[model samples]
Target: MKPLLELRRVFFRYGKRSPYILSGVNLKIIRGKVYCIVGENGSGKTTLLHIMAGLLEPEKGEVLLDGKPLKEQLPRARRLIGILFQNPETMLFNPTVYDEIAYAPRQLFDEGETRKRVLESARLLGIEDLLERPTTSLSYGEKKVVALASIISYDPEIILLDEPLSNLHPERKRRVLNMIRSLAAKGKAVVITSPDLELLDNICDVTLTLSEGRLKEGG
Candidate 1:
């Protein structure tokens, strides 16, 4: 099968004087697969993800979404890729949880479809009870769950989750992992970045390491 996303010889740096965070990085993310990118705190995993999500343009090389250049397919890329940044709750500004969850889908679907998607995603994330509550009133874990519900509401084909298991209780972490597996089962391409490398080894199909501005497969 064709890759859902591809990064070819990508290079990035914060600024002209700054050292490269990602240098000559290349990767292919396929549907129905779960990929884990393991790295230390300053390993540039987050930056790489931003490039994949089309939030950042690489200094060199290209990012392709389903065989087309991502830059050339911005609308399709936005519809196809869902990225949940670390502490994604920080990005949420809606008054209520339901509003937050329904926000993105509203851009692409009608009110009826958006409502259906929001409720379904909330149910899947076990946040149905929090729908009518104030988003600012939620606990950190609750906020995370709400944030995830929001991302999935649009049903993007490629999901990028950064530090998904961080600061969570073991049970919650397990639940998140299971949810990720379920997404892959439905043939979505899932890419995740985490410092906790060994925790996801059992479920990930491929593991790659990011270090000193480069990507290498395994461990």
Candidate 2:
């Protein structure tokens, strides 16, 4: 079978005036494995993740899924790829945690299925107790996991995480790591970007580093 996602000789920059953030980037994201991309701040890790998710197009080369260009397969791609951004809590606008987790499913699924997915996702992330609480009332860790629940509820095939362990407490960080491993165990393609490479050494199956606008294998 083809890889779940592939980035081939990709190139990107904000504008002609800006320096290239990614050049000749190539990667293959496979199912049932955890891939970690480590980079320092401003080294373009997030940019590459966005390109992989089809949120942004590369200036050159291609992002392909199942041997098809991602740009043409976006509608279907959205369901297959889910991205959890850094500081996800900052994007939470729902009144309650339940509403937040339910939002995406409600848009794509029937009411009964939406409810089931919301509850299931919350339970998976150990956030069931926070479902009825106001989103603003959640602690940072609770908010992070709840935001993660929102993505898991959608049941995407490929999950992209940006700085998942950043700013989280020790226990919350452990929870996030466990969740990543769990997702991979279920045959999902899990990709993560982090500045702290050592923290991820034990959990990732294939670890790569982004530096000087290129992605290199191994830390």
The candidate that achieves the highest lDDT relative to the unseen native structure: 1
Runs in model 2 lying further than 4 Å from the true structure: none
State the lDDT of candidate 2 residue by residue for 81-193, as single tens digits: 88888887675899999999998899899999999999998877777888999999987767778888889999999999998887778877787788888899999999999
Per-prediction TM-score: 0.96, 0.94
Each model's C-alpha lDDT? 0.90, 0.89
lDDT for model 2, on a 0 to 1 scale?
0.89
Which clashing pairs does model 1 show?
A: none
Could you tell me how far off, in angstroms, the CA of residue 137 lies in candidate 1 after the best superposition?
A: 1.1
List, residue by residue over 1-219, the lDDT tens digit for candidate 1.
888899999999999999999999999999999999999999999999999999999999999988989999986669899988898668689999999999999999999999999989987877789999999899888888788888899999999998887777787777788899999999999999989787774888889999998999998
